[model samples]
Target: MEKQPSSRLGPLEKLRSFKMEKQKSFRLPGSTSFKEKKYKESPGKRGDMMLHLAARAGNLPHVQMLLAEAGEEGAKDLVSKQNLDGETALYIAAEKGHVEVVREILMVSDLQSASTKANSTFDAFHIAAKQGHLNVLKELLNLFPALAITTNSVNATALDTAATQGHVDIVNLLLETDASLARIARNNGKTTLHSAARMGHVEVVKALLNKDPSIGLRTDKKGQTALHMAVKGQNTGMVLELLRPDVSVINIGDNKGNRPLHVATRKANINMVRTLLSVEGIEVNAVNKAGETALAISEKSGSEEISAVLRVAGAVIEQQQPSPHPPNPAKHLKQTVSDIKHDVQSQLKHTRQTEMRVQKIKKRLEKLHIGGLNNAINSNTVVAVLIATVAFAAIFTVPGQFVEQPTPGYTLGQAFVAQNAAFIVFLLFDSLALFISLAVVVVQTSLIVVEQRAKKRMVFVMNKMMWLACLFISVSFISLTYVVVGKDDWWLAWCTMAIGAVIMLTTLGSMCYCIIMHRIEEKSLRNVRRSSTSQSRSTMSISMPSDSELLNSEYKKIYAL
Candidate 1:
């Protein structure tokens, strides 16, 4: 006869050889030699016996053979034994969609305590529903109709689990068994309908809503209804379904007083927005806890698409406000004062910042202008010195040489003119050019004598003087040409003078263009600064009450002092 293996020297011996923090056992069915630790730590990971493993693997013959080896008493105890997760073999077979194995196990397992032990909350029916095993679920429900009310560890009934998984048939079966199953709140007071809407399960939502029409409006602990979840989930189909069932859901606010429309606009959900607006009974202009309507929220988010949709749907803008329901006159007055103070402070802060920015630009431009002035002064001084030199040399080197002896009625300066009027004009203009050029030099050298404020103006003055000196020099040359060429084609000299005038005009136009370009750049900078200031002001929005509100509440005291 073969000796029975001891628990210590059996297959458990392999498990005991390792240096583990906790001792574990792997006992076969009906074996009593092994010790008992807490069952929470089951053998190995799956903790499946030959019966449970056969049931899970869907080997019907293997399961039946294992059942035969364990007699009727041993088989019932074996089928009822739990695995690591406290699920029985019957529960495992049902969860895996092994309906044949489930039925066979149900014939022998403890139907009363299959998953209803004090330690287990998940039953075969709940597992079947969650796993979408319809045939197994029906069989379990047929045998034990009371399992419909069983909740999991989180107090979720079979209907809640089915709705959460979007198993429509399972949900219908559970709800048909017990209509009250639709109303159970699990996992933070969320009804099954809330779960379905949140998961975008349109069919599941419809089924649950048909079962209990009031379930559509039931809010969770956070005050979120099925409609709120639908909007938040951005499920247009589910949203439309929810709205048709209960149009009053349009006005029901979440914990933040935000209606479905408000949430849709916040999320910029255009499809949901369209669905909500199509319903005539919706409160398009409902205010949230922040006293802002859906329209206001869309505009604030800069979602013009949603805003336009809401506006065309006749969603009116809320009267901008401190909420009208101010609790008392004293708070009203205090709030008014506080709001005004905040607005003033915010505006003053932005104003100061804008002014500082403007000042910085002005200073930067002034520095550039001052730097250009220094260079202009130096350039003009060089031109003036050259002009003075040429003019002085031309005085002696007249158009014609002086007579060998002094010619009668003519000095050496007038010898070239021969007392001709053109000659005299030439001498006079040459003297004028020389004197003007000298004066410009003096002004450029003595620029420091001018006051700081007037120094900038002096640049304009000196620049004009230099141009004048050039004009005089040109005019002098034209006069000399007339004297030399003597009454033949005097208009030629005038043509030359006109050409000089055109040159000066072109120079002036170029200078004007530069100044205009500089001014345009400065104007553009100012515009950019103003744009930034406006953006800052918009971002720093004041939550102040409207003036109308302040007048109606603060100053319009109801009682006399």
Candidate 2:
């Protein structure tokens, strides 16, 4: 054996080292090992090895030689083979911008099978458009025109991708191939114009608009036209281009009712806001679905510059104004009915509260009256006992001395002045006081009434009895005073009588006056309550329309219609 160079590197290692050495000066930190990792990670890369390598290197001669050795059936199989990255040789060739290699592979192989997508979900056509390989894209489209309209996993066509990448030539080429491509939207309802406008692709937007100017009016899923998307970008030129086709697009509302001006104000883009406002016939005061105008949105966002621009443009928040047209009678009737319903509900609520308050006051007064009755019962019991004791003692200890022995017409234990007129008066009055006091005490102790009404009635009767007992007791004391002073000092008794009469009559008259006034006040309160009840009934009759009136109104509405 000839002397061979001693090397420990394997074939795969040799390939990585060769690639690394060739790219040493141009290599970034992690760029050299990418191919090595790709080879190591994918066993499928080992299949159809020469074709993938030739395609990756853009070696047209090597690819041709390999395809020539493998006949037609074998060449198709080799071209259809995928690496671990799911990329076919054609896909690699297209990605590397090898237009000849891509054309060679597509020539003998099935166009669909040759353009099979890799694990990245993009086939040769999409990769070519994304890589801006205009020749490769033209070749793919010429071979397979259906690939132009075909969507990816995201439902984005090649034209959409081209527009997104801001490739104005590719967009123009795709639109020329198929002008309808401008109308095709992605899954998000964004067309090529929307993509171009949002990405601030001024040339691409102009090309798309040149193809179909009406495409600018097409709204996305958000009801946002290209004008709306264009303002979101910083490019005011794109906005002017979009508005050039249709100025009314500035006033168009999205699903949220936000116009371009409103959107610009929200983003605080002063330049965008000014551009939108400068356009003639722009509806600066247009209110959105949320009832917020552009000025309102600007003020809320605290964008003073935007607010000033909008103010200069005569943007005002929309307010509710009375309609100049006559109101519809049916609608008016419905509103009147609603107002009446609300009023009736409120009035009923107030009436119920008033009744509840009246019941509360009545219960509280009854409680106070019961408390007073109980207090009176206790004090009356004590007063009756004291009066009874005084009356009984006065009868036995008369004003005159009692006769001790039987003599002439006098009897033992009899009062000496028993036959006197004043003595008789004292006896009669003392007996009356004693019996009345005893009766009052008996009634209080005997009655054990439990019901509130019956208890109150019993207390009223006992209170009147006690009042009589007090009056009789006072008369008895006054009569005994006359007897004690004797017949010659009868004028002194008269003076005493005068004083007692004045005091007793004054007290009794005051009590009678209080009772009469209380009765008058109670009657007055009753009359006022009756009058109020009648007034409320009359007011309800007037405020609440009757059925006949409602029917007449309905008939009038029908007649007017």
Candidate 3:
């Protein structure tokens, strides 16, 4: 009763065969595996220990087996083994969020001695918190709640690490168990609020401050507070949040004798300056250690926008006095003349650039305007031809048919005089609409083909004529409807006329709305330009695209708490 041979091998057998096979018996010696070969290059040790690799790979069963094979003392030693980086099984498990493995390691390792283990240089709680693993952090804290107060080698507590990485939940958990951990400083004397703001995490910054507002006042090694870091990070949201609790930090100086305003101006951060100016107690005119104010630095940096903002906030620029020890009169006069010539040349060059930019813009607009005009003229020609055909056909086919001329003098439909008046009105309006629309088509075509010199002026004149023709066409359409149904039912005639009026209004309203939005965009662009230096238009920004672009970007410039 022997079994038959299988056609395919199982995975375990395949893997075992792969491990047993050699490259080629004649080529070199028996080849080492890539893992063994790579480890041979390092000589003394493999990269990660088997225990650490099993823990990192989430192999809870293998980890338990390894510990079970080893007796109590041997399993304790295995749990305490470390990799080259000094990270133990618990540390790697905690970092990668392997909860059961971490629990096993914690259960085996001596708790009191393991918290300060020589093999693992870093705190396991800090690693879990920094990596945003709430479950592993909870397990670690449960095993040794005292690890919450322990700082890593870098002197950063779990709370500070969590806040820096934007782990809001982890920070909250650590803070709940040990409320005093919020005030503990990292290596540089900076609190969690400083790290949160520096990392551009507004929610984390607010959360850190909610537990302890005084954390915002603690300065870093650079002698700057959370507001300073927020401004430096160019995070408008974080800056506003930090300043909301304490506006006094707005004027506080750093070790380099730079206030937040000075640093912002040096970096040419226009939004940062705007936020600082928004506060009521901000001293805009206060000078730095160099005896220069934010306005002075902004002026020197050629930031016209920031300078204008500072001036609007009542920042008075100090006037420079002439040197008392003046040079020789003739030498000074010669230097003044040279300076004047240079200024004039710079002004002329800037003016030429401005005119060229304007010409480029006009050319682009002309192309778009001409394209729209051609489309309109083409569509209007089709409509005009249709209207002309209908009008000519109506002249012959009157609403009420003739009755053999009615004895050679009486007009047809004489019994219905009001209906005859309606017919006459329709005929006159229809004729006028046809003629005007036809004329508009001819004029617009001629302007597009031959009239190139006064094209703008001609287009303007043609636009007005096109509107006039549209007005006549609308009136004629309503009159024709009235004539068709005047005697049969006057109510239907009035209803159609009202509907036609509504259609006309809707068409005109769309064009009006576009014009209004464009004007708003123009007004904002003009405001931006107004802050630029009068002596140099080169500093002015390009015109904004549309109202919506301005609205969306408006938040990037300012965010009030």
Candidate 4:
């Protein structure tokens, strides 16, 4: 009887029951609705958040599970989703050295996109490099070899980051992957060597140099090389390492023209100064942009020991004159010549009565003049030979090397850079230097002029040729720099040219000034001599007593006595 029935409810009864159920599910005026609550607790969003957490915890299993649950499209979204710190699951895993987790996430996600997307500052490869996660780096590089060159937010590549952090193995690996990374600089223009040397990473510096020694020659925005950076630290070993490969960098100047020795002196590092000075070819007296030498800087810093070291190493403080104007060598030379002329004229006028004295004076002047000409000839001969030798060597060892095998556009034994404009200019200038120097050598050796005037004329000709040869050698060196430094560093070559131009132009200007001034003085002296002779002739009777007349008057007085 009780079961008869659970009979179906009528339409009004069903409506009443549905209304009761809806009210029970409904929210108050300020309460959250069912749809809003369901959205707030979405599984996919929670799973993504967990994925980041699990990856950071290095839980490879949990990461895989979360990624699988998100499926293909959803897994990509989850893997790329960044937290408040802009860190993705892959970035965190890589940073934490979770190699398996990195590998797992990379397997499912697009590596190019994931690696390219930086988290806050650095991406996975850079972070792993900075963290010294060698295995993680290997995983990233193995999957995407291009990641080795990918730059972080700071415009630093993985190699730069690793070298800065002193990760030797990581640095070596990255270099092996792409040796050009050693040349890649940061936003600050600091290469991997600069960073390693600055950070006092001796081993890392060694590794970098082993890959490419020329990288040691690279300068930063401040015109500082690896040696310049090395001297700033307390590690003398680092300095030695840099010097071992290229001792030429020992004298390389920074923007302020401060070499390593100068910098060490400024820092009051006596040991460093001693070590640098002990190096062969160290320019102890090298002046800086401010005209301060290492000794000068040490004196200014009040470091007695460093100053003593510098002085002992032949470092002399350049004596700067108090004069506000630059020195004029031409004016000095003219004054010297005029004084010599006046002295000689006065001596001759006073000694004219003594024929033997006049002969002696003439012989003395001739001897001195001949000696000067001999010295000039000797110096010119040495310089000419040196220039000729250097030019000969340069022609044989052409920049960019000669072609070993004949190519479609090349012939055997031809220069690889024969067609390059820079190489051609180098060859032309080098040949000119060689031939000009040879000519000078021939003139000095084959010709022998016994007369003083003839010898002076020959010396002058040789001197001019030597100057021209010197200029050609400088131009040749500058032009060859363009071929050596490559196109990317054309500015470096230009800088070398600018510096060489300044020096050469200054020297040539001074030489030209002296020559012009000497000519003008000689012309004026000749005119003065002509005018004096004319006046003596025109006023011979009205003028004061001549030397003969004075001597005769003295003889008459003596006879009266």
Whole-model lDDT per candidate = 0.77, 0.81, 0.73, 0.81
Of 1 and 2, the candidate ranking higher by TM-score: 1
RMSD to native, candidate 3: 16.2
Q: What's the lDDT for residue 458 in model 1?
A: 77
Q: Residue 143 deviation, candidate 1, in Å? A: 0.9
- lDDT leaderboard ranking: 4, 2, 1, 3
| Candidate 3 colliding pairs | none
Q: What is the lDDT of residue 9 in candidate 3?
A: 47
**Angstrom error at residue 285, model 4:** 0.5
lDDT of 1: 0.77
Tens-place lDDT per residue, model 4, 359-378, is 56556655665676788899
Indicate which candidate wins on lDDT.
4
TM-score to true structure, per model: 0.51, 0.50, 0.49, 0.51
* Cα misplacement distance, residue 184 of candidate 2 (Å): 0.9
TM-score of 4: 0.51
Please state every model's RMSD to the true fold in angstroms: 18.7, 23.6, 16.2, 37.4
Higher-ranked by lDDT: 1 or 4: 4
For residue 388, model 1's alpha carbon misses the true position, in angstroms, by 68
- The candidate, 2 or 4, that scores higher on lDDT is 4
TM-score of 2: 0.50
**How well is each residue in 234-334 modelled by candidate 2, as lDDT tens digits?**
99999999988888888888999898988888889999988887888987788787888888988887888888888888888674555679879999999
Model 3 poorest 10 in a row by lDDT: 552-561
